[model samples]
Target: MKRTTIHISAALALLLGLAACTQDEAGFLPEGAEGTPIVFTATGLNPAATAAAGTRAPVDGNWEGVSLVGVLIGGTVKAYDVTPTTADNTSATLTSTDPHYWTNHDDITVTAWWPYTEGETTPPAVVVRADQSSPTDFEGSDFISAENQPVSYGNPTLRFTHRTARVTVVLTDYTEGMASVKLTGLSTENGNPAEIAPYDKGGDTYTALVAPQSVATGTAFITCAFTNGKVFVYKMKEATDWQAGEEYTYTVSLAAAKDPGYTVSEDGKTYEVYNAEGLKNIAELVNEEWKLGINITLTADIDLKGIDWTPIGKDNNKAYTGTFDGGGKTITGLTVTGSNKYAGLFGRIGSGGTVKNVVLEGVQITSDNSSGYASGVAGNSWGTIENCSVSGSVSGSFSVGGVVGYQFGGSITGCSSSASVKGTQRAGGVAGTTNSGATLTACYATGDVTVENDGTSYAWAGGIVGTNGGNSILACYAAGNVSGKGSGTIYVGGVVGENYATVTACYWSGLPDNDNGGATKVDGTNVTWQTAVAAMNAALSGKGWQYELKDGNSLPALKKEQ
Candidate 1:
């Protein structure tokens, strides 16, 4: 929020050196243009904002050193101290928690060096105002707001007009929360703009075009809706020349979550509309990530069989319907895995949805290649998980929980884990890491969470969770052995790795062991394994339930030991 006006060599040189120069110098400013501020104005059917790590603008554009001071969204005015990327050329750019900036959505103005102007000794600024002259406003609505559109094939198709362009963004295996609707633009020459698309493809990636004539040369905007009603902007430059009647191919690929719209059958079993007939199996699951509506009560314990289920994440091509309840069923003896990320009950259960009475056993999960935050129950939980258990290993780089990893704001109640969580970094028992707005309750762990060998030792491994954001953890415990030291640092705890969340009536007793380069000593106070087992039995008895410790047994008992 504070601006530091520094007299850098460029600024000082431009001010002092230009003063001594005459109009004869080529790089010198034009005599009459000295007082006129070099101002830039942009207007178009701005696309909805997209995640920065994903796509840029529909046309090729960059905001390398542009200054964006403000952005306007739904009539609300916000301010920004730094620059925002406006590359998509769609409508508005969607902002993510990453990059940390782009969350504000008011008018953007900056005082940095102009993006395209080379050696121009003038200050640059961007000004935006709603086009009152245009009758039809695609300003507030996302792209897929229109119905009965055409389906896409492998690539995105484009249609052009003098003032507008329509692109049908095609994405295969579009899942819940993992939809891909990215179209950015950049100026081919000096006067162009960059932005992220601003429309929603109704969770499907389709073609949407931008009127390059309506946008500047190097600005992009994403016109999609994010969770917190914020607009993310980017700076882009025209990368190619798109002439009228000339067709050029632009590929936009994103890794998003899957959308599962499961319905209950007459036989009390839940079934998903598997896939469209004749659709090539590019992904294991179609649409975005699978989400449940309410609680999916499973009266019977069923096997998932040998189905290669789909994975999902929190991207454009991901979707979730409601809560998926296993209804006290033993969800075991099956092999399920996804490409992006997958949850047991729902992909993203919002800040509601309670997942209880389920057991995830003998499940094998592969690691997410790029963005981490994969979990056994859900990707990034914001609800309550109770009376559940997980017994499989999860591998990813960041944001992983045994029962639930990367909780934003939720509760993990009465759950336990006996799985091995392996990741390149940031691994935890209950949650890999948590924000300051989450709560954990009545949870325990006995897993061996470790980090793989990497060059640097900067890992954040722990027993319960790698880190916590001020929440409540009542009657919870952890006993996992945290290890790995290649670029990893031990933050292990008997109950939690780092407890910003409250731990009441909880304790830890797992053996603290580490391998080479790891801190051999455990981080928490000694609670002893026997005490931990007794506490587990006592909690189960009080709840009229039973539990089994990780003692060598082919078939673990469910009843509490006498």
Candidate 2:
């Protein structure tokens, strides 16, 4: 390990700015006389050092204006704001706002540290931050001090020593603005993690100020996140005790992948999944092993190319009750085909379950049984589904939708689906049949919903939902055509085939050639795709959401998409 230290010492000292000045002129009274104000002058170091953005320290042999330092004499503490006095910055003048005077001839031991805390007599706390990405933030995390040093009133020599250990990670294949590294595997407890960011120094130089602590043996501390999406973790082969005023450097050069695709937290309740197998593991844990309360998060976009899919939950009795946050990542090429009922990415989401911030692209879900249900996200939902989307196609016999086949006794908010749907009984763009006070808020669907008859009786199809079923649909829209063919008493609508719920500020585009399945039809005011985004945004205000177009697409998108 290489070493580098940040040490500051005074080079030259001059007392009272003039050698011929008397004690009265310098405000220094006789020994044990009236109290006198203490004057100060701080000298500079020999070598040059670079200061961060807001620390006001010296950078390249020049001080960045007034540098603040705290001085403590006996039980009193005062601030000393120092400024440069020489062209080369080897000399400086230190002044205090709240001046502390010399009361007696006895010399009081002085202690000092860079940067002072206002309205506090005790020394500042030393809890380091997790983010040191910016220079100002990095500099602010450093606490330098000169403890129990002697001071001369005429020419005080104050020097600062580094109070923390500095660590530098040099990536052999580092790229500008394309790579990142973090110090991991630190001791964390009570829900607080020590996530240390490497302070970038242009090109390949990255340094981090770490609090002095012991690095346990074989602990992987530095995680090198490469630009090609490869991660390499460097472990300490031997335990090293880090002390203040010392620096450690690690040069990394690895040619192989080191990550296992799944990083579980210390508490074992959360998992950051990075691949398709890891995602499948979550489903197996939730359904097979009954680990229903674990939380799963996606760290990267996964591609399900050739792997056959199994829904997270098998049925309503064995529904997924865990929380899954996608971290705004996508899962592409999801294919679910079976004759089983309650089928989708998730078979059923039970009460208290939540799934959000996920996008399913190019999905194909097909149900063979005549009474089965199929969709993109879930077949049936009794929980919360928020800020999710789907595309491609979905087909089934009984109930089918682009996002969910059946929604009951749960809430769906800020979700969208653009997949084309085909079904026999009830088909919809967003949901097939929503009942039991199911709520839909700020949701939209833009798929062509069709109801076909093979051996089924009358069918119903809608743009947003097939059957409202006395639920609540608020500030939602559907921009696709809803139609029916080869069915007895076929019913269709722009919003819903049957409306028995509270529909507030809902809109739809061109549907229901005849009647809106006993419901009112939509007009051009809220149906135009150009202005529909803003209008829906205005309608969903104070609902904890808004709308915007994502990636130059003309369709309205939720905030999670951004």
User: Per-candidate TM vs. native?
Assistant: 0.42, 0.52
Tens-place lDDT digits, model 2, residues 1-562: 1222222111122443345375556555654444666666554332443232212232223444337877788787888887777777765666776767776555567777765676656556455568888877777667667778777655566655556667877766534334668998765533324778878876566777767788998888988666668666789988997766566778776434433456788998888999997888777777888877788899999998677788888675678887889888999988888786987888898898898988999998988878888899999998999989999999997888888898988888988999999999889899988889999888888989998866457787888888778478877888799888883777788888767788877777657654343323445453354466666677777778887766444666667332
User: Model 2: which residue pairs collide?
Assistant: none
- The sequence of per-residue lDDT tens digits that candidate 1 reaches over residues 180-290 is 234454333333234434334344544434433343455553233234333333333454433322223333332232322233467633442332211112122323323
lDDT value, candidate 1, whole model:
0.47
Ten residues in sequence with the least summed lDDT for candidate 2? 4-13
- Global lDDT scores for all candidate models: 0.47, 0.75
What 10-residue stretch in candidate 1 is worst by lDDT? 140-149
lDDT of 1 at 501: 52
- What residue runs in model 1 are displaced by over 4 Å at the alpha carbon? 1-295, 311-321, 333-346, 453-457, 488-490, 513-562
Distance from true location, Cα of 441 in model 1, Å: 1.6
